[model samples]
Target: MTKKDKYQKVAYYPGCALEGTGHSYNRSTKAVGKALGLDLVEVENWNCCGAMEVKNVDPKLQTYLSSRVMSTAANEMDMDVVMAPCNGCYHNLKKAEYDLKHDPESVEVVSKLSQKAGHKTYEAGQVETIHALDWIKDTVGEEGLKERVKNSLNGIKVANYYGCMYTRPRHIFPEKDQGPGSESTSKPHFMDDLLAAAGAENVEFPLKTACCGGAHTLSDSDTSTKLVLNILKAAKLAGADVIATECPTCHSGLEMHQIRAEKVLGETVDIKILYFTQLLGVALGLKPRKVGVHENVSDSRGFLKERGLA
Candidate 1:
């Protein structure tokens, strides 16, 4: 089948970061998907879910707001699976769907809220929530990904970082979903597989799924420093040359604030962090800047140069 026929109607949810702070994420995901033969159809009228803070302040209100966004994909656009590239949006949308489906009171409250926002009705299973990483693993396949690897990540060790939100709330994630073959959440090892396919050595990181403190870095700086430091330390201990992650939040938290983390943690370690999509783009024979490798705080250019890819 042709590429258009393969993914005739895939919904791409850019979320808040994809447009602004996480703009690189949308670009990289779109580029990688296109290179690997998946035409990503982004949702046109999508909005933000306000991440954890909104849900924490008022669960009911947050659910209503999130439901409206999901309803847009379901009722208005008629999408089967809404591929959320951002972890925050993925979790928020998944949570709202679950609450509306399982709890009648929540459903009724959110229904009215949806109407207030000019929406018809929010239904359960309207749009199946999924992460881009999961979709890439399934549609692209290991062998297909292998074929796209033009340049191997030789002599470079990678540490896979999966922050919070990407994998939580047991309800949205199926038991089998956690497996390599399922479409449940963002699998860091999926990136590892792609890296390995490109002939790179993926360090078996013990703290691959560890939290990177996210926005908490702003409020609880000390605790956040420790969290970021530990993950970096884990990567260093495992002999990783660079840390790789899919979430932009994790990338910002760890990479953008490496200097601060070093001062707080009392050690200066040489490490760089890159988004998993950027790495995938490199493997797909795309230029580094096109995939957002330049946006990172660490000089990832050197990593690419050493490998003769720059």
Candidate 2:
């Protein structure tokens, strides 16, 4: 079937971060889906994707963790597609899928673990994993977004920040030539295209796939702060009022470090950080609370209110 038809309903996997600091992303994602007449069936009995410390410590262990999540979706839920909002989760699941298919060691480890844990082992090609960006972009094209926009973000200048992830070493991403979407490794523009469809002007920001240093946030505070500050400063210099992010870690890192940089380094960059889903929700005329904009670490209600969005 067509992507517009197939992706209308899929397994939604909101990783660990979404329930905590990235709650705004969770809320806004569901809100935008509802506004657009789409359906999402949450995955059952999900687990972490091992994008955190587990991966560094044990690579196979990380692959196992990600495999379990996909296992529940495919084996139990009988799903053909799994949608992840966080980039880390998306990247991890894709990595696990790739590993299980190609690497005999990963398959052997996961199989042994699944047998011991009394759960079905996840086999590759059973389900297709996609980012939330892919879910909406494939199902709802730019024209669909433009048709659904209730409040035009005509005056907003946005700098789209796609974090440095999804660089699947196995080249496991689906073929981009099938009219699904373009998966440009060098410069991904799904976020930019979505915002532009909502009437926002995307700035010429050079940092598309830059690292947000989220993995080093706790382990190295100064380094994380410096990395975040560079992104904030560059967005400001590009005349962007907001830096739109898709990943929860990247979103929270931008929000938290934006505050830390000001208090610690005394470098205050006056730019609002928002999830792209939150921006899309507002453009779709959903209330601020509906999109959890007020729940963001850095408040943008006043800023959006000034522009008649709130």
Q: Which candidate is the best by lDDT?
A: 2
Q: Write one digit per residue (lDDT tens) for candidate 1, span 28-85.
A: 8888888887867777677777687887788887788777777787778877678887
- Give the best candidate by TM-score: 2
In order, candidate lDDTs are 0.76, 0.90
- Runs with alpha carbons beyond 4 Å of true place in candidate 2: 168-170, 174-180
Displacement of the residue 305 alpha carbon in candidate 2, Å: 0.7
RMSD of each: 2.7, 1.5
The runs of at least 3 residues in candidate 1 whose Cα sits more than 4 Å from the true structure, single-residue gaps closed, are: 1-8, 175-180, 183-188, 263-266
lDDT of candidate model 1 versus the reference: 0.76
Cα shift from native, residue 186, model 1 (Å): 12
Q: Write the per-residue lDDT of candidate 2 for residues 174-265, one digit (tens) a residue.
A: 54434436767666788888999999999999877778789998789889999999999999999999999999999999888888999999
